[model samples]
Target: MDALYVPQGRSRRFVEQATNLHHFRLGIFLEVIDLHLQELDNRFNERNMELLTFMACLSPKGNFSSFDKENILKLASFYPEEFSSVDVMTLELQLDVFMDNMLSDERFCGLQDLNSLSMMLVKTKRHENFPLVYFLIKLMLILLVATTSVERVFSAMTCVKIKLRNSMGDQFMNDCLVTFIEKEVFLQVPDEKIIDHFQNMKTHRMNL
Candidate 1:
Protein backbone atom coordinates (compact mmCIF):
# COMPACT_ATOMS: atom_id res chain seq x y z
CA MET A 1 0.00 0.00 0.00
CA ASP A 2 3.00 2.34 -0.47
CA ALA A 3 1.17 4.54 -2.96
CA LEU A 4 2.11 8.05 -1.75
CA TYR A 5 5.28 9.76 -0.58
CA VAL A 6 5.66 10.29 3.21
CA PRO A 7 7.47 13.24 4.86
CA GLN A 8 11.08 12.35 5.68
CA GLY A 9 10.58 13.29 9.40
CA ARG A 10 7.23 11.42 9.89
CA SER A 11 6.64 7.92 11.28
CA ARG A 12 5.97 5.05 8.86
CA ARG A 13 2.64 4.47 10.71
CA PHE A 14 1.24 7.89 9.66
CA VAL A 15 -1.07 6.20 7.12
CA GLU A 16 -2.12 3.61 9.73
CA GLN A 17 -2.77 6.32 12.36
CA ALA A 18 -5.04 8.17 9.88
CA THR A 19 -7.05 4.94 9.40
CA ASN A 20 -7.18 4.35 13.20
CA LEU A 21 -8.71 7.81 13.80
CA HIS A 22 -12.02 6.75 12.22
CA HIS A 23 -12.02 3.51 14.22
CA PHE A 24 -11.27 5.30 17.52
CA ARG A 25 -13.82 8.02 16.72
CA LEU A 26 -16.58 5.50 15.94
CA GLY A 27 -15.75 3.45 19.06
CA ILE A 28 -16.02 6.52 21.35
CA PHE A 29 -19.21 7.68 19.57
CA LEU A 30 -20.99 4.33 19.83
CA GLU A 31 -19.82 3.98 23.46
CA VAL A 32 -21.33 7.37 24.33
CA ILE A 33 -24.63 6.55 22.55
CA ASP A 34 -24.86 3.11 24.20
CA LEU A 35 -24.24 4.63 27.67
CA HIS A 36 -26.98 7.22 27.12
CA LEU A 37 -29.50 4.58 25.95
CA GLN A 38 -28.52 2.24 28.77
CA GLU A 39 -29.01 5.02 31.33
CA LEU A 40 -32.48 5.74 29.93
CA ASP A 41 -33.33 2.02 30.12
CA ASN A 42 -32.27 1.86 33.78
CA ARG A 43 -33.95 5.16 34.71
CA PHE A 44 -37.39 4.30 33.30
CA ASN A 45 -38.29 1.56 35.78
CA GLU A 46 -41.74 -0.08 35.69
CA ARG A 47 -43.01 1.54 38.91
CA ASN A 48 -41.87 4.99 37.77
CA MET A 49 -43.48 4.49 34.39
CA GLU A 50 -46.73 3.26 36.01
CA LEU A 51 -46.76 6.22 38.42
CA LEU A 52 -46.18 8.64 35.52
CA THR A 53 -49.00 6.93 33.58
CA PHE A 54 -51.21 7.26 36.66
CA MET A 55 -50.37 10.97 36.81
CA ALA A 56 -51.74 11.23 33.26
CA CYS A 57 -55.17 10.64 34.83
CA LEU A 58 -55.22 14.40 35.35
CA SER A 59 -55.76 14.59 31.59
CA PRO A 60 -59.33 14.32 30.30
CA LYS A 61 -58.40 11.84 27.55
CA GLY A 62 -57.43 8.13 27.52
CA ASN A 63 -60.23 7.08 29.92
CA PHE A 64 -58.37 9.19 32.48
CA SER A 65 -61.22 9.23 34.95
CA SER A 66 -61.23 5.43 35.16
CA PHE A 67 -57.82 5.35 36.86
CA ASP A 68 -57.74 3.72 40.32
CA LYS A 69 -58.08 6.26 43.14
CA GLU A 70 -56.11 4.11 45.62
CA ASN A 71 -53.13 3.85 43.25
CA ILE A 72 -53.23 7.61 42.60
CA LEU A 73 -53.37 8.26 46.35
CA LYS A 74 -50.39 5.96 46.95
CA LEU A 75 -48.36 7.76 44.28
CA ALA A 76 -49.24 11.13 45.78
CA SER A 77 -48.19 9.96 49.24
CA PHE A 78 -44.82 8.77 47.93
CA TYR A 79 -43.76 12.18 46.55
CA PRO A 80 -43.15 14.10 49.80
CA GLU A 81 -41.67 17.04 47.92
CA GLU A 82 -44.93 17.62 46.10
CA PHE A 83 -47.22 16.54 48.97
CA SER A 84 -46.17 17.02 52.57
CA SER A 85 -47.39 15.01 55.59
CA VAL A 86 -50.58 17.04 56.16
CA ASP A 87 -51.04 17.50 52.41
CA VAL A 88 -50.60 13.80 51.69
CA MET A 89 -53.11 12.84 54.40
CA THR A 90 -55.95 14.78 52.72
CA LEU A 91 -54.66 14.28 49.13
CA GLU A 92 -57.22 11.56 48.32
CA LEU A 93 -59.98 13.75 49.73
CA GLN A 94 -58.70 16.63 47.58
CA LEU A 95 -58.42 14.35 44.55
CA ASP A 96 -62.00 13.16 44.99
CA VAL A 97 -63.22 16.73 45.46
CA PHE A 98 -61.11 17.90 42.48
CA MET A 99 -62.53 15.17 40.20
CA ASP A 100 -66.07 15.93 41.32
CA ASN A 101 -65.59 19.66 40.84
CA MET A 102 -63.74 19.27 37.52
CA LEU A 103 -66.39 17.02 35.95
CA SER A 104 -69.08 19.55 36.81
CA ASP A 105 -67.11 22.52 35.36
CA GLU A 106 -67.60 22.75 31.59
CA ARG A 107 -64.20 24.50 31.08
CA PHE A 108 -62.25 21.73 32.83
CA CYS A 109 -64.30 18.99 31.15
CA GLY A 110 -63.22 20.23 27.73
CA LEU A 111 -59.49 20.13 28.66
CA GLN A 112 -57.51 17.25 27.12
CA ASP A 113 -53.76 17.00 27.88
CA LEU A 114 -52.03 17.48 31.26
CA ASN A 115 -50.49 20.79 30.00
CA SER A 116 -53.86 22.20 28.90
CA LEU A 117 -55.44 20.94 32.11
CA SER A 118 -52.69 22.60 34.19
CA MET A 119 -52.94 25.92 32.32
CA MET A 120 -56.75 25.87 32.18
CA LEU A 121 -56.89 25.38 35.94
CA VAL A 122 -55.20 28.78 36.31
CA LYS A 123 -57.35 30.43 33.61
CA THR A 124 -60.53 29.03 35.24
CA LYS A 125 -59.36 30.35 38.67
CA ARG A 126 -59.37 26.78 40.05
CA HIS A 127 -55.62 26.19 40.56
CA GLU A 128 -55.94 27.56 44.08
CA ASN A 129 -59.04 25.46 44.78
CA PHE A 130 -57.04 22.23 44.52
CA PRO A 131 -53.58 23.58 45.41
CA LEU A 132 -51.88 20.28 46.35
CA VAL A 133 -53.32 18.37 43.41
CA TYR A 134 -52.41 21.19 41.05
CA PHE A 135 -48.92 21.27 42.53
CA LEU A 136 -48.61 17.52 41.90
CA ILE A 137 -49.62 18.01 38.26
CA LYS A 138 -47.19 20.90 37.84
CA LEU A 139 -44.43 18.90 39.57
CA MET A 140 -44.96 15.96 37.25
CA LEU A 141 -44.83 18.31 34.25
CA ILE A 142 -41.66 20.01 35.51
CA LEU A 143 -40.02 16.63 36.11
CA LEU A 144 -40.89 15.39 32.62
CA VAL A 145 -40.11 18.62 30.77
CA ALA A 146 -37.21 20.10 32.75
CA THR A 147 -35.08 16.94 32.45
CA THR A 148 -35.19 16.99 28.66
CA SER A 149 -34.88 20.80 28.60
CA VAL A 150 -31.54 20.84 30.49
CA GLU A 151 -30.22 18.02 28.33
CA ARG A 152 -31.20 19.93 25.18
CA VAL A 153 -29.46 23.07 26.42
CA PHE A 154 -26.20 21.18 27.02
CA SER A 155 -26.47 19.48 23.63
CA ALA A 156 -26.96 22.84 21.94
CA MET A 157 -24.04 24.34 23.87
CA THR A 158 -21.76 21.57 22.57
CA CYS A 159 -22.63 22.62 19.00
CA VAL A 160 -22.51 26.37 19.70
CA LYS A 161 -19.34 26.52 21.78
CA ILE A 162 -17.15 24.73 19.25
CA LYS A 163 -13.32 24.60 19.04
CA LEU A 164 -13.32 27.93 17.18
CA ARG A 165 -15.11 29.62 20.12
CA ASN A 166 -13.32 27.63 22.83
CA SER A 167 -11.46 30.74 24.00
CA MET A 168 -14.76 32.50 24.87
CA GLY A 169 -15.17 32.97 28.64
CA ASP A 170 -17.90 31.19 30.59
CA GLN A 171 -20.14 34.25 31.27
CA PHE A 172 -19.88 35.58 27.71
CA MET A 173 -20.46 32.09 26.28
CA ASN A 174 -23.52 31.73 28.53
CA ASP A 175 -24.95 34.99 27.18
CA CYS A 176 -24.31 33.83 23.59
CA LEU A 177 -25.92 30.47 24.36
CA VAL A 178 -28.99 32.10 25.94
CA THR A 179 -29.41 34.31 22.89
CA PHE A 180 -28.89 31.38 20.51
CA ILE A 181 -31.19 28.95 22.36
CA GLU A 182 -34.13 31.32 22.88
CA LYS A 183 -34.83 31.94 19.20
CA GLU A 184 -38.16 33.74 19.74
CA VAL A 185 -36.68 36.06 22.35
CA PHE A 186 -33.66 36.80 20.14
CA LEU A 187 -35.90 37.52 17.14
CA GLN A 188 -37.72 40.35 18.95
CA VAL A 189 -34.43 42.20 19.62
CA PRO A 190 -33.31 44.72 16.98
CA ASP A 191 -29.75 44.04 15.78
CA GLU A 192 -29.10 47.67 14.83
CA LYS A 193 -30.03 48.86 18.31
CA ILE A 194 -27.67 46.26 19.83
CA ILE A 195 -24.85 47.42 17.52
CA ASP A 196 -25.52 51.08 18.34
CA HIS A 197 -25.44 50.37 22.07
CA PHE A 198 -22.20 48.41 21.85
CA GLN A 199 -20.65 51.00 19.54
CA ASN A 200 -21.56 53.80 21.96
CA MET A 201 -19.91 51.92 24.86
CA LYS A 202 -16.40 52.63 23.39
CA THR A 203 -15.37 55.25 20.86
CA HIS A 204 -14.25 53.88 17.45
CA ARG A 205 -12.57 55.95 14.68
CA MET A 206 -14.97 54.56 12.04
CA ASN A 207 -18.24 55.66 10.46
CA LEU A 208 -21.34 54.61 12.45
Candidate 2:
Protein backbone atom coordinates (compact mmCIF):
# COMPACT_ATOMS: atom_id res chain seq x y z
CA MET A 1 0.00 0.00 0.00
CA ASP A 2 2.92 2.38 0.84
CA ALA A 3 4.60 1.78 -2.57
CA LEU A 4 1.30 2.32 -4.44
CA TYR A 5 0.98 5.70 -6.20
CA VAL A 6 -2.53 7.18 -5.86
CA PRO A 7 -3.48 9.68 -8.52
CA GLN A 8 -5.37 12.69 -7.08
CA GLY A 9 -8.70 12.05 -8.91
CA ARG A 10 -8.59 8.22 -8.74
CA SER A 11 -7.66 8.11 -5.03
CA ARG A 12 -10.70 10.23 -4.14
CA ARG A 13 -13.21 8.62 -6.55
CA PHE A 14 -16.70 8.28 -5.03
CA VAL A 15 -18.79 5.13 -5.36
CA GLU A 16 -22.53 5.72 -6.07
CA GLN A 17 -24.17 8.28 -3.71
CA ALA A 18 -21.43 8.19 -1.04
CA THR A 19 -19.95 11.64 -0.23
CA ASN A 20 -16.78 10.29 1.45
CA LEU A 21 -14.32 9.34 -1.27
CA HIS A 22 -11.96 7.40 1.05
CA HIS A 23 -14.65 4.86 1.93
CA PHE A 24 -14.40 1.82 -0.44
CA ARG A 25 -16.63 -1.09 0.53
CA LEU A 26 -16.13 -4.48 -1.25
CA GLY A 27 -19.91 -4.71 -1.87
CA ILE A 28 -19.97 -1.28 -3.56
CA PHE A 29 -16.96 -2.19 -5.72
CA LEU A 30 -18.62 -5.49 -6.69
CA GLU A 31 -21.73 -3.59 -7.82
CA VAL A 32 -19.58 -1.35 -10.07
CA ILE A 33 -17.76 -4.49 -11.39
CA ASP A 34 -21.13 -6.18 -12.05
CA LEU A 35 -22.22 -3.24 -14.25
CA HIS A 36 -18.89 -3.26 -16.16
CA LEU A 37 -19.22 -7.05 -16.72
CA GLN A 38 -22.83 -6.58 -17.89
CA GLU A 39 -21.58 -4.04 -20.47
CA LEU A 40 -18.97 -6.55 -21.73
CA ASP A 41 -21.63 -9.29 -21.92
CA ASN A 42 -23.89 -7.03 -24.05
CA ARG A 43 -20.96 -6.22 -26.37
CA PHE A 44 -19.80 -9.85 -26.93
CA ASN A 45 -23.18 -11.57 -26.84
CA GLU A 46 -24.11 -15.11 -28.04
CA ARG A 47 -24.18 -14.42 -31.79
CA ASN A 48 -20.61 -12.97 -31.91
CA MET A 49 -19.24 -15.88 -29.83
CA GLU A 50 -20.93 -18.47 -32.09
CA LEU A 51 -19.41 -16.80 -35.20
CA LEU A 52 -15.94 -16.82 -33.59
CA THR A 53 -16.36 -20.51 -32.64
CA PHE A 54 -17.24 -21.37 -36.25
CA MET A 55 -14.09 -19.52 -37.39
CA ALA A 56 -11.98 -21.64 -35.02
CA CYS A 57 -12.98 -24.69 -37.10
CA LEU A 58 -10.78 -23.21 -39.91
CA SER A 59 -7.65 -24.35 -38.06
CA PRO A 60 -5.76 -26.96 -40.10
CA LYS A 61 -4.34 -28.57 -36.92
CA GLY A 62 -7.33 -30.87 -36.74
CA ASN A 63 -8.62 -33.06 -39.62
CA PHE A 64 -9.81 -30.78 -42.44
CA SER A 65 -12.77 -32.04 -44.46
CA SER A 66 -14.80 -30.96 -47.54
CA PHE A 67 -17.42 -29.48 -45.15
CA ASP A 68 -14.91 -26.86 -43.85
CA LYS A 69 -14.59 -25.23 -47.34
CA GLU A 70 -17.54 -22.97 -46.51
CA ASN A 71 -15.61 -21.72 -43.45
CA ILE A 72 -12.57 -21.13 -45.71
CA LEU A 73 -14.73 -19.18 -48.15
CA LYS A 74 -16.03 -17.06 -45.26
CA LEU A 75 -12.45 -16.40 -44.12
CA ALA A 76 -11.34 -15.35 -47.63
CA SER A 77 -14.42 -13.09 -47.96
CA PHE A 78 -13.17 -11.05 -44.96
CA TYR A 79 -9.68 -10.52 -46.49
CA PRO A 80 -9.68 -9.03 -50.02
CA GLU A 81 -5.98 -8.13 -50.22
CA GLU A 82 -4.60 -11.68 -50.19
CA PHE A 83 -7.64 -13.51 -51.56
CA SER A 84 -9.35 -12.12 -54.67
CA SER A 85 -12.46 -13.59 -56.39
CA VAL A 86 -10.19 -15.43 -58.88
CA ASP A 87 -7.91 -16.46 -55.94
CA VAL A 88 -10.94 -17.75 -53.96
CA MET A 89 -12.04 -19.81 -56.95
CA THR A 90 -8.55 -21.33 -57.24
CA LEU A 91 -8.31 -21.99 -53.43
CA GLU A 92 -10.64 -25.02 -53.64
CA LEU A 93 -8.41 -26.70 -56.21
CA GLN A 94 -5.24 -25.65 -54.29
CA LEU A 95 -6.65 -27.00 -51.02
CA ASP A 96 -7.63 -30.27 -52.71
CA VAL A 97 -4.13 -30.63 -54.17
CA PHE A 98 -2.48 -29.70 -50.84
CA MET A 99 -4.63 -32.16 -48.89
CA ASP A 100 -4.15 -34.85 -51.52
CA ASN A 101 -0.34 -34.45 -51.24
CA MET A 102 -0.68 -34.67 -47.47
CA LEU A 103 -2.68 -37.89 -47.80
CA SER A 104 -0.21 -39.50 -50.22
CA ASP A 105 2.99 -38.37 -48.47
CA GLU A 106 3.93 -39.55 -44.95
CA ARG A 107 6.17 -36.54 -44.08
CA PHE A 108 3.53 -33.99 -45.12
CA CYS A 109 0.70 -35.77 -43.26
CA GLY A 110 2.83 -36.09 -40.04
CA LEU A 111 3.10 -32.24 -39.68
CA GLN A 112 1.21 -30.90 -36.65
CA ASP A 113 1.61 -27.13 -37.00
CA LEU A 114 1.57 -24.42 -39.70
CA ASN A 115 5.19 -23.49 -38.94
CA SER A 116 6.36 -27.04 -39.69
CA LEU A 117 4.04 -27.20 -42.69
CA SER A 118 5.45 -23.91 -44.01
CA MET A 119 9.04 -25.09 -43.48
CA MET A 120 8.33 -28.27 -45.46
CA LEU A 121 6.83 -26.17 -48.24
CA VAL A 122 9.91 -23.92 -48.27
CA LYS A 123 12.18 -26.97 -48.19
CA THR A 124 10.50 -28.33 -51.30
CA LYS A 125 10.25 -24.75 -52.72
CA ARG A 126 6.48 -25.11 -53.09
CA HIS A 127 5.34 -22.29 -50.75
CA GLU A 128 5.35 -19.62 -53.52
CA ASN A 129 2.92 -21.75 -55.60
CA PHE A 130 0.25 -21.75 -52.82
CA PRO A 131 0.24 -18.00 -52.19
CA LEU A 132 -2.96 -17.64 -50.12
CA VAL A 133 -2.49 -20.62 -47.81
CA TYR A 134 1.26 -20.08 -47.29
CA PHE A 135 0.83 -16.34 -46.74
CA LEU A 136 -1.95 -16.99 -44.19
CA ILE A 137 0.21 -19.53 -42.35
CA LYS A 138 3.18 -17.10 -42.42
CA LEU A 139 1.02 -14.21 -41.15
CA MET A 140 -0.18 -16.34 -38.23
CA LEU A 141 3.41 -17.48 -37.51
CA ILE A 142 4.67 -13.84 -37.51
CA LEU A 143 1.96 -12.81 -35.02
CA LEU A 144 2.73 -15.74 -32.73
CA VAL A 145 6.50 -15.05 -32.93
CA ALA A 146 6.13 -11.28 -32.39
CA THR A 147 3.83 -11.80 -29.35
CA THR A 148 6.06 -14.47 -27.72
CA SER A 149 9.26 -12.47 -28.49
CA VAL A 150 7.97 -9.37 -26.64
CA GLU A 151 7.12 -11.40 -23.52
CA ARG A 152 10.45 -13.31 -23.77
CA VAL A 153 12.48 -10.04 -24.18
CA PHE A 154 10.88 -8.57 -21.01
CA SER A 155 11.52 -11.84 -19.12
CA ALA A 156 15.14 -11.92 -20.37
CA MET A 157 15.72 -8.22 -19.46
CA THR A 158 14.62 -8.96 -15.88
CA CYS A 159 17.12 -11.85 -15.60
CA VAL A 160 20.05 -10.29 -17.54
CA LYS A 161 19.93 -6.65 -16.29
CA ILE A 162 18.46 -6.42 -12.78
CA LYS A 163 18.35 -3.26 -10.57
CA LEU A 164 22.01 -3.76 -9.54
CA ARG A 165 23.06 -3.79 -13.22
CA ASN A 166 20.69 -1.00 -14.31
CA SER A 167 23.59 1.05 -15.76
CA MET A 168 24.45 -1.65 -18.33
CA GLY A 169 25.33 -0.28 -21.83
CA ASP A 170 22.68 -0.69 -24.53
CA GLN A 171 24.74 -2.97 -26.85
CA PHE A 172 26.15 -5.03 -23.95
CA MET A 173 22.69 -5.37 -22.35
CA ASN A 174 21.23 -6.47 -25.74
CA ASP A 175 23.98 -9.10 -26.19
CA CYS A 176 23.45 -10.54 -22.68
CA LEU A 177 19.65 -10.42 -23.08
CA VAL A 178 19.86 -12.31 -26.39
CA THR A 179 22.00 -15.06 -24.77
CA PHE A 180 19.68 -15.30 -21.74
CA ILE A 181 16.54 -15.33 -23.88
CA GLU A 182 17.76 -18.13 -26.18
CA LYS A 183 18.48 -20.72 -23.46
CA GLU A 184 17.56 -23.62 -25.75
CA VAL A 185 20.11 -22.47 -28.35
CA PHE A 186 22.84 -21.91 -25.71
CA LEU A 187 22.15 -25.36 -24.21
CA GLN A 188 23.37 -27.05 -27.41
CA VAL A 189 26.79 -25.26 -27.23
CA PRO A 190 29.53 -27.32 -25.49
CA ASP A 191 31.48 -25.34 -22.82
CA GLU A 192 34.54 -27.64 -23.04
CA LYS A 193 34.75 -27.17 -26.84
CA ILE A 194 34.42 -23.39 -26.42
CA ILE A 195 37.24 -23.37 -23.78
CA ASP A 196 39.47 -25.48 -26.06
CA HIS A 197 38.83 -23.10 -28.98
CA PHE A 198 39.62 -20.08 -26.77
CA GLN A 199 42.86 -21.76 -25.58
CA ASN A 200 43.84 -22.61 -29.17
CA MET A 201 43.36 -18.96 -30.22
CA LYS A 202 45.98 -17.85 -27.59
CA THR A 203 49.31 -19.35 -28.79
CA HIS A 204 51.83 -16.86 -27.15
CA ARG A 205 50.82 -17.61 -23.50
CA MET A 206 53.20 -20.25 -22.08
CA ASN A 207 53.00 -22.59 -19.02
CA LEU A 208 55.47 -20.32 -17.05
Candidate 3:
Protein backbone atom coordinates (compact mmCIF):
# COMPACT_ATOMS: atom_id res chain seq x y z
CA MET A 1 0.00 0.00 0.00
CA ASP A 2 2.80 2.40 0.90
CA ALA A 3 4.56 1.72 -2.41
CA LEU A 4 1.50 2.46 -4.59
CA TYR A 5 2.18 6.24 -4.85
CA VAL A 6 -1.20 7.15 -3.37
CA PRO A 7 -2.38 8.60 -0.03
CA GLN A 8 -3.03 6.11 2.76
CA GLY A 9 -6.82 6.12 2.42
CA ARG A 10 -6.70 5.81 -1.38
CA SER A 11 -3.93 3.23 -1.22
CA ARG A 12 -6.00 0.96 0.99
CA ARG A 13 -9.01 1.20 -1.29
CA PHE A 14 -6.95 0.82 -4.45
CA VAL A 15 -5.11 -2.21 -3.12
CA GLU A 16 -8.36 -3.94 -2.21
CA GLN A 17 -9.84 -3.22 -5.63
CA ALA A 18 -6.63 -4.31 -7.36
CA THR A 19 -6.56 -7.54 -5.35
CA ASN A 20 -10.12 -8.42 -6.31
CA LEU A 21 -9.51 -7.69 -9.99
CA HIS A 22 -6.27 -9.68 -9.88
CA HIS A 23 -8.09 -12.66 -8.40
CA PHE A 24 -10.85 -12.45 -10.98
CA ARG A 25 -8.42 -12.27 -13.90
CA LEU A 26 -6.30 -15.04 -12.39
CA GLY A 27 -9.34 -17.25 -12.05
CA ILE A 28 -10.23 -16.68 -15.70
CA PHE A 29 -6.67 -17.42 -16.87
CA LEU A 30 -6.49 -20.56 -14.76
CA GLU A 31 -9.80 -21.77 -16.09
CA VAL A 32 -8.65 -21.15 -19.67
CA ILE A 33 -5.43 -23.10 -19.12
CA ASP A 34 -7.28 -25.93 -17.41
CA LEU A 35 -9.69 -26.12 -20.32
CA HIS A 36 -6.75 -26.12 -22.71
CA LEU A 37 -5.20 -29.07 -20.89
CA GLN A 38 -8.48 -30.94 -21.03
CA GLU A 39 -8.66 -30.22 -24.74
CA LEU A 40 -5.12 -31.50 -25.30
CA ASP A 41 -5.96 -34.69 -23.45
CA ASN A 42 -9.11 -35.14 -25.46
CA ARG A 43 -7.18 -34.54 -28.67
CA PHE A 44 -4.63 -37.18 -27.83
CA ASN A 45 -7.21 -39.69 -26.65
CA GLU A 46 -9.46 -39.25 -29.69
CA ARG A 47 -6.90 -38.74 -32.38
CA ASN A 48 -8.12 -41.71 -34.41
CA MET A 49 -11.72 -40.67 -34.24
CA GLU A 50 -10.84 -37.09 -35.03
CA LEU A 51 -8.73 -37.95 -38.06
CA LEU A 52 -11.37 -40.31 -39.37
CA THR A 53 -14.21 -37.90 -38.82
CA PHE A 54 -12.30 -35.00 -40.32
CA MET A 55 -11.45 -37.00 -43.40
CA ALA A 56 -15.02 -38.18 -43.75
CA CYS A 57 -16.40 -34.70 -43.38
CA LEU A 58 -14.07 -33.37 -46.05
CA SER A 59 -14.75 -36.12 -48.57
CA PRO A 60 -17.67 -35.68 -50.95
CA LYS A 61 -18.40 -39.42 -51.12
CA GLY A 62 -17.48 -40.43 -47.58
CA ASN A 63 -19.99 -41.35 -44.90
CA PHE A 64 -19.67 -40.24 -41.27
CA SER A 65 -22.01 -42.79 -39.68
CA SER A 66 -19.23 -45.26 -38.84
CA PHE A 67 -17.03 -42.56 -37.38
CA ASP A 68 -19.96 -41.28 -35.36
CA LYS A 69 -20.69 -44.75 -34.02
CA GLU A 70 -17.07 -45.27 -33.03
CA ASN A 71 -17.05 -41.91 -31.23
CA ILE A 72 -20.14 -42.86 -29.23
CA LEU A 73 -18.57 -46.16 -28.22
CA LYS A 74 -15.36 -44.43 -27.13
CA LEU A 75 -17.33 -41.91 -25.13
CA ALA A 76 -19.35 -44.66 -23.48
CA SER A 77 -16.17 -46.47 -22.55
CA PHE A 78 -14.66 -43.33 -21.08
CA TYR A 79 -17.78 -42.40 -19.12
CA PRO A 80 -19.82 -45.55 -18.67
CA GLU A 81 -21.99 -44.20 -15.86
CA GLU A 82 -22.82 -40.99 -17.68
CA PHE A 83 -23.34 -42.24 -21.25
CA SER A 84 -25.32 -45.38 -21.88
CA SER A 85 -27.79 -46.21 -24.68
CA VAL A 86 -30.47 -43.88 -23.31
CA ASP A 87 -27.92 -41.14 -22.66
CA VAL A 88 -26.63 -41.37 -26.23
CA MET A 89 -30.13 -40.93 -27.61
CA THR A 90 -30.70 -38.01 -25.26
CA LEU A 91 -27.39 -36.40 -26.20
CA GLU A 92 -28.07 -36.72 -29.93
CA LEU A 93 -31.56 -35.30 -29.51
CA GLN A 94 -30.23 -32.42 -27.46
CA LEU A 95 -27.52 -31.72 -30.02
CA ASP A 96 -30.10 -31.72 -32.82
CA VAL A 97 -32.32 -29.36 -30.86
CA PHE A 98 -29.37 -27.09 -30.14
CA MET A 99 -28.36 -26.99 -33.77
CA ASP A 100 -31.94 -26.32 -34.80
CA ASN A 101 -32.16 -23.40 -32.40
CA MET A 102 -28.84 -22.04 -33.66
CA LEU A 103 -30.02 -22.24 -37.24
CA SER A 104 -33.23 -20.39 -36.39
CA ASP A 105 -31.62 -17.64 -34.30
CA GLU A 106 -29.61 -14.90 -35.96
CA ARG A 107 -27.49 -14.34 -32.86
CA PHE A 108 -26.40 -17.96 -32.72
CA CYS A 109 -25.93 -18.65 -36.43
CA GLY A 110 -22.59 -16.85 -36.54
CA LEU A 111 -21.20 -18.86 -33.63
CA GLN A 112 -18.51 -21.43 -34.33
CA ASP A 113 -19.58 -24.87 -35.43
CA LEU A 114 -19.23 -27.62 -32.83
CA ASN A 115 -17.88 -30.10 -35.38
CA SER A 116 -15.12 -27.71 -36.40
CA LEU A 117 -14.40 -26.98 -32.76
CA SER A 118 -14.12 -30.68 -32.04
CA MET A 119 -11.70 -31.14 -34.92
CA MET A 120 -9.60 -28.19 -33.79
CA LEU A 121 -9.44 -29.49 -30.24
CA VAL A 122 -8.19 -32.80 -31.56
CA LYS A 123 -5.60 -31.20 -33.82
CA THR A 124 -3.96 -29.11 -31.07
CA LYS A 125 -2.49 -32.05 -29.15
CA ARG A 126 1.26 -32.47 -29.14
CA HIS A 127 3.54 -35.34 -28.29
CA GLU A 128 4.54 -35.76 -24.64
CA ASN A 129 8.22 -35.15 -25.49
CA PHE A 130 7.53 -31.78 -27.17
CA PRO A 131 5.44 -30.24 -24.40
CA LEU A 132 7.71 -27.19 -24.15
CA VAL A 133 7.22 -26.20 -27.80
CA TYR A 134 3.46 -26.01 -27.57
CA PHE A 135 3.57 -24.28 -24.20
CA LEU A 136 6.18 -21.79 -25.41
CA ILE A 137 4.06 -20.86 -28.43
CA LYS A 138 1.00 -20.43 -26.22
CA LEU A 139 3.00 -18.38 -23.70
CA MET A 140 4.27 -16.09 -26.46
CA LEU A 141 0.73 -15.48 -27.74
CA ILE A 142 -0.51 -14.74 -24.21
CA LEU A 143 2.39 -12.34 -23.58
CA LEU A 144 1.79 -10.56 -26.89
CA VAL A 145 -1.89 -10.03 -26.09
CA ALA A 146 -1.21 -8.98 -22.47
CA THR A 147 1.60 -6.57 -23.31
CA THR A 148 -0.48 -4.96 -26.04
CA SER A 149 -3.38 -4.42 -23.63
CA VAL A 150 -1.11 -2.96 -20.96
CA GLU A 151 0.63 -0.64 -23.40
CA ARG A 152 -2.67 0.67 -24.70
CA VAL A 153 -3.93 1.39 -21.19
CA PHE A 154 -0.68 3.13 -20.27
CA SER A 155 -0.88 5.28 -23.37
CA ALA A 156 -4.47 6.29 -22.57
CA MET A 157 -3.52 6.99 -18.96
CA THR A 158 -0.69 9.24 -20.13
CA CYS A 159 -3.14 11.24 -22.24
CA VAL A 160 -5.56 11.50 -19.32
CA LYS A 161 -2.86 12.60 -16.89
CA ILE A 162 -0.89 15.04 -19.05
CA LYS A 163 1.78 17.33 -17.57
CA LEU A 164 -0.52 20.39 -17.58
CA ARG A 165 -3.67 18.43 -16.65
CA ASN A 166 -2.42 16.43 -13.69
CA SER A 167 -4.86 17.89 -11.19
CA MET A 168 -7.66 15.33 -11.63
CA GLY A 169 -10.48 14.77 -9.13
CA ASP A 170 -10.47 11.35 -7.50
CA GLN A 171 -13.69 10.23 -9.15
CA PHE A 172 -12.56 11.57 -12.52
CA MET A 173 -9.23 9.81 -12.20
CA ASN A 174 -10.96 6.49 -11.42
CA ASP A 175 -13.31 6.88 -14.35
CA CYS A 176 -10.48 7.81 -16.72
CA LEU A 177 -8.43 4.82 -15.60
CA VAL A 178 -11.36 2.46 -16.08
CA THR A 179 -12.14 3.83 -19.51
CA PHE A 180 -8.50 3.62 -20.57
CA ILE A 181 -8.17 0.00 -19.47
CA GLU A 182 -11.49 -1.13 -20.90
CA LYS A 183 -10.82 0.41 -24.30
CA GLU A 184 -7.13 -0.43 -24.55
CA VAL A 185 -5.60 -1.11 -27.96
CA PHE A 186 -2.26 -2.41 -29.19
CA LEU A 187 -0.37 -0.53 -31.89
CA GLN A 188 2.94 -1.58 -33.35
CA VAL A 189 5.70 0.98 -33.92
CA PRO A 190 9.46 1.30 -33.67
CA ASP A 191 10.65 2.40 -30.25
CA GLU A 192 13.01 5.00 -31.59
CA LYS A 193 10.34 7.05 -33.40
CA ILE A 194 7.49 6.09 -31.06
CA ILE A 195 7.36 9.28 -29.03
CA ASP A 196 7.58 11.62 -31.99
CA HIS A 197 5.34 9.49 -34.15
CA PHE A 198 2.73 9.04 -31.44
CA GLN A 199 2.49 12.79 -30.82
CA ASN A 200 2.26 13.53 -34.52
CA MET A 201 -0.31 10.80 -35.13
CA LYS A 202 -2.41 11.84 -32.18
CA THR A 203 -2.41 15.44 -33.43
CA HIS A 204 -3.27 14.34 -36.94
CA ARG A 205 -6.03 11.97 -35.83
CA MET A 206 -7.34 14.25 -33.07
CA ASN A 207 -7.12 11.34 -30.61
CA LEU A 208 -5.22 13.27 -27.96
Give the number of the best model, judged by lDDT. 1
Query: Candidate 2 lDDT, tens digit per residue, 53-84?
Result: 44454344544432266665666666688788
- Those runs of model 1 whose alpha carbons end farther than 4 Å from true positions after fitting are 1-51, 74-79, 104-107
Candidate 1: worst 10 consecutive residues by lDDT? 15-24
The residue pairs that clash in candidate 2, if any, are: none
lDDT of 2 at 40: 78
What's the distance in Å from true for residue 201, model 1?
Answer: 1.7
* Candidate 3 per-residue lDDT over residues 75-178, each given as its tens digit: 43444564566755655454444334334544432324334323332354421323322232243345447757776777777788887768888789778777
lDDT of 1 by residue, 14-133 (tens): 644334445455656778998998888777878778777677666666435655677677778768776777887777788888878877877776556879888888998788888878
lDDT values for all models: 0.76, 0.67, 0.47
Clashing pairs in 3: none
For all predicted structures, in order, the TM-scores are 0.65, 0.44, 0.26
Question: What total of clashing residue pairs does each candidate reach?
Answer: 0, 0, 0
Ranking by TM-score: 1, 2, 3
What does the lDDT read for residue 13 in candidate 1? 77
